[model samples]
Target: MERSTEFLSDIDMVVGPRGHRRWPDAVKAQIVAETLVEGATVGAVARRYDMRANHLSEWRRMAREGKLVLPAVTEEPKFAALVVRDDVETTPDPEPRSPLDLIFGAVTVRLDAGTSAARIAEIARALNASS
Candidate 1:
């Protein structure tokens, strides 16, 4: 059999430090913080730091899970509690309603204000069937 050495000519040697990189927790938190800025994105921040977006996302997850601690914010967030009391009585709807009257021959039917359209239609249907 003849030897084939043609494929070896195209291979180029690349020698450099290429392996897993160790990122400090503080640096990871800072990169994660950059993503929190308004209009900033994970891919953009990761590219800026020469890292992968997924790695930055993992750091963000770590920060969320308390595995990583982010720097404190300059301004404190304020939240107001909304109190709902079950002891308070419910009030009727305040919507204004107009009276309605239905007349069938010599008989007249009066409906209360705010009666639903479906109920009115049902009553009218019943009255028509009875007539």
Candidate 2:
């Protein structure tokens, strides 16, 4: 190989201060919420967001501690109509009936028979939103 001491002058320089980025609380909450989804892992979520897993874990801890509030991931109505069977007997029975059961995926909530429709709707919406 012949020794050629020619200088290559073509060079591109990127000049910017490298520092820690400040993420908005809303953005942080959104990212944390993604980790809460079923079958989502902290490492996977962090990688998807181009962040460190430990940092995401810290944010999750903050959420648990109530220091950070995650926005509800619901796009539907907050309350739903509670439906009752017209065939339900209005007269008092000799035996107390079982509590009203609200099933959401793997979770089941038992509400009293006298529970208000609004309250039942609120509980159902909450359960549906969580899932």
Find the candidate with the highest lDDT and give its number: 2
- Provide the TM-score for each candidate, comma-separated: 0.43, 0.45
CA lDDT for candidate 2: 0.79
Worst 10 residues of 1 by lDDT: 7-16
Off by over 4 Å in 1: 1-17, 75-131
Q: What do the candidate models score in CA lDDT, each in turn?
A: 0.77, 0.79
Query: Which tens-of-lDDT digit does each residue in 72-113 have in candidate 2?
Result: 887554677899899986876667766999988889898998
lDDT of 1: 0.77
How many backbone clashes does every candidate have?
0, 0
State in Å the error of residue 111, model 2: 33
Question: 5, model 2: CA deviation in Å?
Answer: 38
Q: What's the lDDT for residue 106 in model 2? A: 88
